[model samples]
Target: MNYTVNQSWKILLPLSHLSPNYLHEHQLFQRQTGKSFLRKIGGGMDKFPISPEILRPTIVFDNEINKVARALGLKGKRMPYETANGTLNVNIHYYFEKYIVLDVVFKQRISFGDISLLQKSRLSSYPEIESLVLAIAGLIVSGNQQSYSPLTSIPTIRCFSIQSLDDNQFSNMELVEALTGHIEPTQRIIDDVLARNSGHQTSGPIITLIDKQGVIQFIPNKPKLTKDALQKYSSCCNLLELMLVIEQSIKDGHLDSNNVFLSALKSLVEKPEDIVKSYTAQRTIKQYSKDFHLESRLSDLTKKIELASSVLISEKKTLRRGWDEFYASNDFFQVLFTALVAGLVTGFGILWAFLKGL
Candidate 1:
């Protein structure tokens, strides 16, 4: 809530380090990377790509950034910094696998009164600091979709709280809760087009990362797969619920399944518009499956026709060639005609002589 953030969170995350360890203990941290497990199953597994939201970059002291990063957990990554009024101010840039990207902005603000924050004010469910962390985590998970199968990547949206009390650009920082669930561009740019070999990659070899942008590689997937497996398989429920969802999309001229997929994906992230950018893979799959079936049928028919034509043509050519070669020297038709004429002449002469003698 705006009532409290004006004074307190400065000592909350970094100085106190309360949220970082909690982030690491998350079960998602227990999952393997794309390279390790992806190779074993090839393209078969659907593991979540979401990295733990706990990223604590090295904080620098004594004018050297390197020393600070090693102290925190950043073994060897460069620090993000900006020059203001001839002074170099550095902040921790924490990136997650699927959810969010955020800078642990450390600012120093002068204390004013006993203004500890309004004790009686109700807190808004959506808080800015929590929002950034959640957003970045969503990004990393959605980024490496090839690892997760049909489970879609959550979008990366950001929210941040200033560690310093100075009333500068950090002054009117708006309060937000839904990280990737909401829209904020300062926190949403993705690194794309990871390359491999010269053989023209189809959809392979692209890097799987989760940045602030929504699910990157393909269309974001639907969340219906999350419907309780028990419900999905139970006779009390429609055993073919998913099957009908697919069948209707194809034969019934209905795009309902696709809409559901999109709706659920949008709900996963804070941004409603990001849903539009995703490919309607479910719809495309339905349409393409039908096309593939038709094409296969056509291909089989064409092959049969070609085989018949080839057999008929081969027989005709063989007969013509054989006749030409066999008759080349014989001339059987001419011999037969000459023999018939000689027989008739001989017969007539004999008959005339006999008649004259008589």
Candidate 2:
């Protein structure tokens, strides 16, 4: 039975980290409904049907356009057109309920001439086109969510294009191949950014795609690295050494092993720079050296200091206890000694008197 395409049938591409069971369930749902999946597009088309100039410029923008189309419940079609730029594959999305069409043009490198050309396009008269222009401008400023707002609420025909200098790295065939899930176009962009910014202290600009709601639709999740794994890859020597110290503290019951290890691992992964800075500062202190003898001496010194404090406290407690006992017993020992001394002196006086009389 043929099913009519509806809003419910709108397809969402699987996130790279989706579980296999979720993917399988989605496949089953598609089969049961006899609905076409988004990934099936371009599979039956002739490979590289368009010129490389047009394909490369447009393909990088497809991921964002696809997300926008899906979110707005619009169906997308690739139409071929001839321009001075080359044979452009313009994507048109039809919103049946609103009776609106959106024309998305992509220029690997946009120029003032290109903007003028787009202004002359047939759909330029629509009010939505102005919003589309602003949205595209926002995207160009920073390929991030802060640049754009949702355009789906504008219920009219709209036209926009992405202009970027990085369009040359991909070709039409590669973009078409990506549609069939044979390659990940988003990952290619990330790899390109990383390649361009290799060894740089600053992070590269993050390329993001937004939906009609101005929500970021494409964000790559960094791989979660474990403590052991991070130690193996750490560039700072002190991180691993500190991990050893923390581990020893855990073993000696000075720290909660699970909590401390997790916290350390998180900080190492999320804020390695902070850790490196702290480690560098500690290394500057002579007493913080990693030499075994030095470390042992420091540990021994800590123990000796603690022992001296305990001894002082114990002696104070013993003296206080003795004073309390003497007061409570009415000084019996003191009185007995005094009596013995007095009796001896009296007997000696009596013997002297007798000797004198004789």
The candidate scoring highest on lDDT is 2
Q: What's the CA error at residue 140 for candidate 1, in Å?
A: 17
Say which candidate scores most in TM-score.
2
Cα deviation at 301, candidate 2, in Å, is 73
Query: Model 2 reaches what TM-score against the true structure?
Result: 0.18
- Give residue 66's error in model 1 in angstroms: 6.1
Worst 10 residues of 1 by lDDT: 3-12
Off by over 4 Å in 2: 1-37, 40-79, 86-100, 106-108, 111-204, 209-358
lDDT of each: 0.28, 0.31
lDDT of 1 by residue, 1-358 (tens): 1111211111111112222332343322333233321112112211213111333332221223333334433333443322121111222222222112222332222233443212111112223322333333332333321232221222221222122222222110111111123233132221111211112212322211111211111111222322321111121111111122222223332332344433332232323223222232222222323323433433444455567779999999999988877567476667667888899999999999999999
Tens digit per residue, CA lDDT, model 2, 247-288: 334334333324444454344334444443333222321212
Give the lDDT of residue 260 in candidate 1.
46
